[model samples]
Target chain A: MAVRTPTGSPSGRALGLGAAAALLLLVGCCTVGLSMELQGTVSLEGRLFPQASAYQGQEDYDASLVLEPELYWEGEGGLSCSLKPFLRLDTSDPERSHSDLREANLLYGADSWQLLFGLDKVFWGVTEFVHLVDIVNQTDLVESPDQEEKLGQPMLALSLEQEWGTLEAYLLPLFRERTFPGSRGRLRGPLVIDSGAAEYESGAGRTHPDLALRYSHTLGNLDLGLYQFFGTSREPLFLPSAGQEEELIPFYSQISQTGLDLQLVEGQWLWKLEALQRSGQGPGRGAVACGFEYTWVRPWQLDLDLGFIAEYVRDQRRLADDSPYDNDLMLGMRLGLNDAQGSELLLGMVQDLAQPSCFMVLEAGQRLGESLHLSLSGYLFVRTAEQDPLRFYQQDSYLLFKGSYYF
Target chain B: MKRSLMLLLLLALMPVSPLQALAETPEEQGHAIAVEADRRSSGFGDCTADTVMILRNREGQENRRQLRSRVLEQEDDGDKSLTLFDSPGDVRGTILLTFSHKRGDDDQWLFLPALKRVKRISAANKSGAFMGSEFAFEDLGSRELEKYGHRYLGSESLDGRECFVLEQIPLDSKNSGYSRIISWLDTTTYRLIREEYFDQKQRLLKTLFCREYQQYLGFLWKAHRLEMVNHQNGKETDLLFANYRFQVGLTDRDFRKNRLKNLRTGGGR
Candidate 1:
């Protein structure tokens, strides 16, 4: 998936010196004998209310930098190889400057069988508010609006572990498109997602061939999974651009999903669930989310930990439109603080049990002396009922601050 | 006076002997020193080590980590480890995977190398910490003598050997954060040399020690440094251990969580 569609205004100092000369020519071709690592991250982002003007004049403070350099090779029987190249640089949005490869894979293992090949990133469900069976890499919305960044997917997996579970199989042959939010981004979507007119409805669009399968297992305290997929629709559907005036186009249809996930640890609770079902996107639909999380350890003695969460979400294509969680509900809390510079916090809201609109988030992070990190987040939008799908974000309530640095 | 009240009702119907139940009590000598320290650390069926954690704080500032473990030892339940996280380029290729149990609760999994996913950790935070180190994922598992509740408490000399302190207590104190723990051991080889812990309002909070001691295959004793400190966060954590190999033939599919994402190449050896 993910074929670099980083829009417009280039030349940020010649793409930062051609990404430092392609990361010093891939660390001098993976240091000859191979086994290398060179982590990266450097951030400083800000933004606290720039309420519109599309903020295109750019500058609510920004700065980003990333450069991961990993390469590992091994060969002799169970083969192995990895290449991770990812670079990013942004300073006031040049379409959120981008770069990515993130693991050019190749692996093989024998015993219980395994294999993998090229471009990866996989993450599937286990609730944190949303991620309905994670749909293979395609959301990097400018890097955050928290769809939890992803992009990079070209597959050929195969696995099998057996004692009853593991099993996997995939083939997916290219079709990535999904990286929006940069018309000077700010919780976007009021038109403007026209990456040079993307469209497809199959007829073998981007060489469409997708197919997937999964099965996972665990039993003592429950952990299960099931998956299925079949081509073209990593979510895109934004019509209205018959000649451009207000812009927007991105249709991609052909679907067939089916997912299920479940957790259930029990001892400080953790329940979670995710369900999905889609089918050629015209009438079939289904969705679900369920939750629990408990925690509360260390209670207060300076070594804290809290947790709490709740969830419920539904969608049966609520009014046949975009479906912002037809009957949502969420609630949260988290707190951590198990010291040594690894503090944390998180709050949440969601609500819209039929629309009075809620949303609301908050986040926090800390760890600043062992490779730096500091974060703060916010987002709010309350009572916005103009048929709330967040009513175009109601001025995009914001607040952010980041500061990373890790290598 | 009625024949001295019939000899005090036959001395209150007495009958107590067998040398006073073989002269044992104090919780049966603290459950016979925890079943003789779990039968001298049992069979030595699987091992493999290499650890080095440092973590200092309180202005002594320091941080380091590099681990690789793989235990197995389960002859009746409680033991199955797997650590991995060699060097910190942001927790290298993480991986935890525990499985301990002896009567209820104990299973963990973590694998998160920047979320390639395998979470499922909820042993209810076993007193947290663990990677931020002052130990505690309930002090890295396998203390299974049915999860505790003992008591002997007496004997002295620690450091000059001759120990045996005992005291336990934690039969699931709501998933334990220590409402007691004393330990000392080593009255002729039960090993363990020092621990304290307390909290849950009983105060004292931490102080472990373990120091040098190597015995391996001649009946396994191993402990080359273990520190701990943290009396209410003055922070400290040492650990050290090195190499150690024993048995090597692990099983139960090598501590699976789908084998923790390739647990670093051939799952270390």
Candidate 2:
């Protein structure tokens, strides 16, 4: 059928030219040897809403439409290459756009000495809710509109998923894209310190590129994450629009966090916990935000996400008078749809007043057919303000609609 | 994926050159050599297609079913046999699966669920689509190998291994797709390693390759990866056997008339 792309007029032309060039280059290369693959998907979400706050509500419709490259791989002569570019849109807000370019590199994986040079997901950690898709330390959710490059967030990393354990290292040329690339955007359920970029400097007072050690080590069922974001903390990568400076605030030269992520599963119960500590970056901002969530599968998936945040968030910024002691709690339920296919639908609600007040969301996604899918969702801003609301009930809401394909 | 595999490879690959003349054509010794070569090469197992497949349409949705492969049966030329099920309630009484070696005729019968009576599946409509899939009724049969003949065409290395090559052709006209079939069977157990099937027009239309063979139950053989590539449609099917079990004491008693309906009632729920 017909597909709707997920980029504005400016990038639409650029993306088309680039994707077409990639496709042609791949097709032409087939003359020399085996063919390289091209896979993509486009996810789209459209929502009609009346209120806007950084906080997402459980029932608020965060409807989105997406389109990603259809991904495929061909094996011949021991060398394999995978090419993918993901583009998605939320007609909900152009400012809240997302996209990515990924060529999970080329590899000559034989009996041993397997190495990869492309962009791929580097799975690390075992924290259930957050770690289930913890393959890459780069960007996952591309929320913002302006993206800097194709292969959106590129990383030259190598990994050995060995029998004993796994070892990995990445050259995150741009660290900002590592932490808050702002593209994969953020969902309301929980908080993951997205991606951070390392900034560099010049002796003449110019800002060069910085580096970071975004690595992970596995010890049995436990994983340790060591991330040191070394950059002129305030050196911005992209120019801000209008009142965007506050949202993209930068203060110092470096901020690093070390944490232990654990995953343990017994029978139908799964437990995930993370303990983190941040330090040496100026003032009160260096604190810890950790939580543990346990989920059960047999009877049905009922997940409870309780977070504890003790922080005086650093050197310089404040839009409104905020508190250092913020504790948020969220509960969610996932109902299984089809056992043959293991399809499911989810419902969740949370009260994290410290971050962006109180919000509730109701979202449902189902595999429509063999190749098509559909989702219906909406969200509500239950209550906002560090102090409890006087009325305790009035709230604004937004509803969303989404559909996708895998062919 | 599963449809085309049975389509191009099953009958269309039948060898037809057995009618060729060789030496004296004495009682047609090497005359139809191509047809003889075809049968002598592929599908040489003492196999039986006791396929007990049930087509399911989505519940309450016009023609859709929740096709829960409720029952399966395996039989060899020997007394060894087996039949399995998702439930015992159905095969308890009545069910009938008919196999007509003839090309265009095949039928099935079952005492359906909700309706406790005998029913017949149309045999004449062999080419009609099954569950709107590419597979036709004629394709699901254990057409006796003797029904077709084969001849050896010597040996050659294929995909890096030396194999015994043969060609085959169906004895009857109204049977399968191949004007003739060329096959490379492994010298060991006569298992099909690679086969090239030609259409009625004598053009190579498809190829079937079997790999990663493992012996199951001393009698049953398994091909972990069976690939059927279509020359017409740019799509290829790779059937990966993640799990398979054969001859676990299943019997004809499991393939009764009453069992079909019993299993369908709650087959996939």
Best prediction by DockQ: 1
lDDT of 1 by residue, B1-269 (tens): 24323433432343542212432677756766676677688789888888888899889988776788888888778888888876554456778888888878888888886667888868855877777788888887788877788878777996577887889898888778889889898877788888899988899988899988899888779888999998886989899988788887777676778656655632345
Model 1 per-residue lDDT at A344: 84
Report the poorest 10 consecutive residues by lDDT, candidate 1 chain A.
Answer: A1-10
Candidate 2 lDDT by residue in tens digits, A1-407: 11123444333444455556555655544555664444333456665555443434223334566655534344554455555665555534333445555443454443322455544433333331222112233333334211112233234555444444434445544332322323222332112121221222333121224344444433422334544443333222332223433233222334344444443322223344544444444354333333333322122211121222121211121111212124455555655432222245566555653555555557676554344556667666576654532112233365667665544
For model 1, name the residue pairs that clash. Answer: A1-A153
Error of model 1, residue A164, in angstroms: 43
User: For candidate 1, what is the DockQ-based docking class?
Assistant: incorrect
lDDT of 1: 0.74
lDDT for each of the candidates?
Answer: 0.74, 0.40
Return the TM-score for candidate 2, rounded to 2 decimals: 0.47
List chain B TM-scores, each candidate.
0.30, 0.57
Q: What lDDT does candidate 1 reach at residue B224?
A: 83
Scoring the B chain of model 1 against the true B chain gives a TM-score of: 0.30
